[model samples]
Target: MRLLHTMLRVGDLDRSIAFYTDILGMKLLRRQDYPEGRFTLAFVGYQPESEGAVLELTHNWDTASYELGNGYGHIALGVPDAYAACEAIRAAGGKVVREAGPMKHGTTVIAFVDDPDGYKIELIQRD
Candidate 1:
């Protein structure tokens, strides 16, 4: 079976949407509000859900923040140029926590950016 979407609980839906769509160049695939649950789920991705895995951003009406415990790790994205990606993300007002460069003890180029909810996204140069 193929993998599906990754769910991230965001505090501010609008802010998270902007970061993923505006800064990261992803599209808002779909969204629906669960009035009874007091939550909303918005899907974002580089391609349609039928073609590739996407992200699910869940916003709980009453929750403003998450601890993001140490067990969690950053999500990774393949890029043609990690350095250029970092630059573009920064130019778009995204926070680049690590500059693009060769990874530690390895030669693969990589960079990191943080989302509105403090989630790390790793950009790995593939070609």
Candidate 2:
């Protein structure tokens, strides 16, 4: 079966949305609020959800922060140029935790950036 989407619980929905959509150059595919569940979900990605996997940002009405426990790792995105992507992310007020460089023990260039909710996103350069 094909993979669907990755869900991340964000403390600030708006901030997270901006980070994914504005800073990372992703599109907000859809968003919905569940009043009864007291939560909201927003899907974002580079392409349509039907075409590829996307990211789901979940925001609970009562929760303002998350610990992001140890088990959670970073999400990875393929880019044309890791260096350029990192530079653009930094110019857009995004946090670049790791500078663009070749992966350890490998030649694949990569970089890391943190979202508004402190979620790490890995950028891998692709030919």
The TM-scores, one per candidate, come to: 0.98, 0.97
TM-score of 2: 0.97
Q: Identify the runs in model 2 with alpha carbons over 4 angstroms from their true place.
A: none
In model 1, which runs have C-alpha deviations exceeding 4 angstroms? Answer: none
- Give residue 44's error in model 1 in angstroms: 0.3
RMSD in Å for all candidates? 0.6, 0.7
For model 2, the local distance difference test gives: 0.95
Per-residue lDDT of candidate 1, residues 53-115 (tens digit)? 999999999999999999889999999999899989999999999999998999999999999
For model 1 the local lDDT of residue 25 reads 94
